[model samples]
Target: MKMKLIDRFGKRLLYGSVLTALSAVLSVYVYAQDGKAGIQEANDKVRGYFSVGCDLMYAVGAILGLIGAVRVYQKWSNGHPDTGSTAAAWFGSCVFLVIVATVLRSFFGIQQ
Candidate 1:
């Protein structure tokens, strides 16, 4: 009968809508996480690596210093007129690296 068909169609539509809404709610619950926990985890991870990062910066600075010393030595031995300026520039770069690392470490309150 036409009336029976209409009733069946209406029921199907209503059931489909309910099911869709339920699935959406369930998906949201499944995917949702504690935002504070996520942020704390990220913070802890960065803090843990902070010391290592600072150490790496120090190592880089040391390497640069050594290289600079060698270059300065070579220039001086060759009687280059700009040798003093070159030495000063290299020394400045090494010092700048050290200062930057120290500043960042202290600024972030990172431990030794």
Candidate 2:
């Protein structure tokens, strides 16, 4: 079991690394194009993508927070022993998602 888990992990890590490297190389190639037009095109595309991503993040965070609130309320009403930890986990994830989205937008220099 241990050996199988290790093998699976190694394979996953290798695949992830390979994909990351491939994307990096492709992005570099795209950005290396000559002329101002090429650079502006790339910048616009990236900015659009970032804007969409941030919007999606906000939607997802709102949904997650709602679900978490409901779950916590149910657990609290039921007097579950693990309710506190479960609530904490859910709230924490919701906050983290919002924070990450906000930070990414700021880091990308995106103007609302």
Candidate 3:
């Protein structure tokens, strides 16, 4: 007796779906953990690394300041008409970076 190919395929598909659903349901009970614990762990990790993040921001700001200084000097020496605007933009960016870092740390109450 030859089994129909389509019937065999459908039976296999049904078996696979049942197995997948069973495994997923079992896993949910096997790996259940406290949500609050997970959230607290994440909070601790972020707080631990916050100071490093702030330091990196400060370093970036310092580098930008130096680059801006050199660029402004070049523009001034070359008598570029947009020198003033360029300088203002670069200065504002550096200040913004420092301010953001400070504000975030304060807002999050993360202390060094």
Top candidate when judged by lDDT against the true structure: 3
Candidate 3, poorest ten consecutive residues by summed lDDT: 29-38
How high is the CA lDDT of each candidate model? 0.94, 0.92, 0.94
- Model 2 scores worst on lDDT over the 10 consecutive residues at 30-39
- Weakest 10 consecutive residues of candidate 1 by summed lDDT: 29-38
TM-score for candidate 1, please give it: 0.69
Error of 3 at 39 (Å): 1.2
lDDT per residue as tens, model 1, 17-98: 9999999998877766677787888999999999999899899999999999999999999999999999999999989989
TM-scores for the candidates: 0.69, 0.64, 0.77
Give the root-mean-square deviation of each candidate in angstroms.
9.2, 12.3, 3.1
- Please tell me which predicted candidate would have the highest TM-score against the true structure: 3
Error of 1 at 107 (Å): 0.6
Q: What ranking emerges by TM-score with the best candidate at the front?
A: 3, 1, 2
Model 1 CA deviation exceeding 4 Å by range? 1-32
Error of 1 at 59 (Å): 0.7
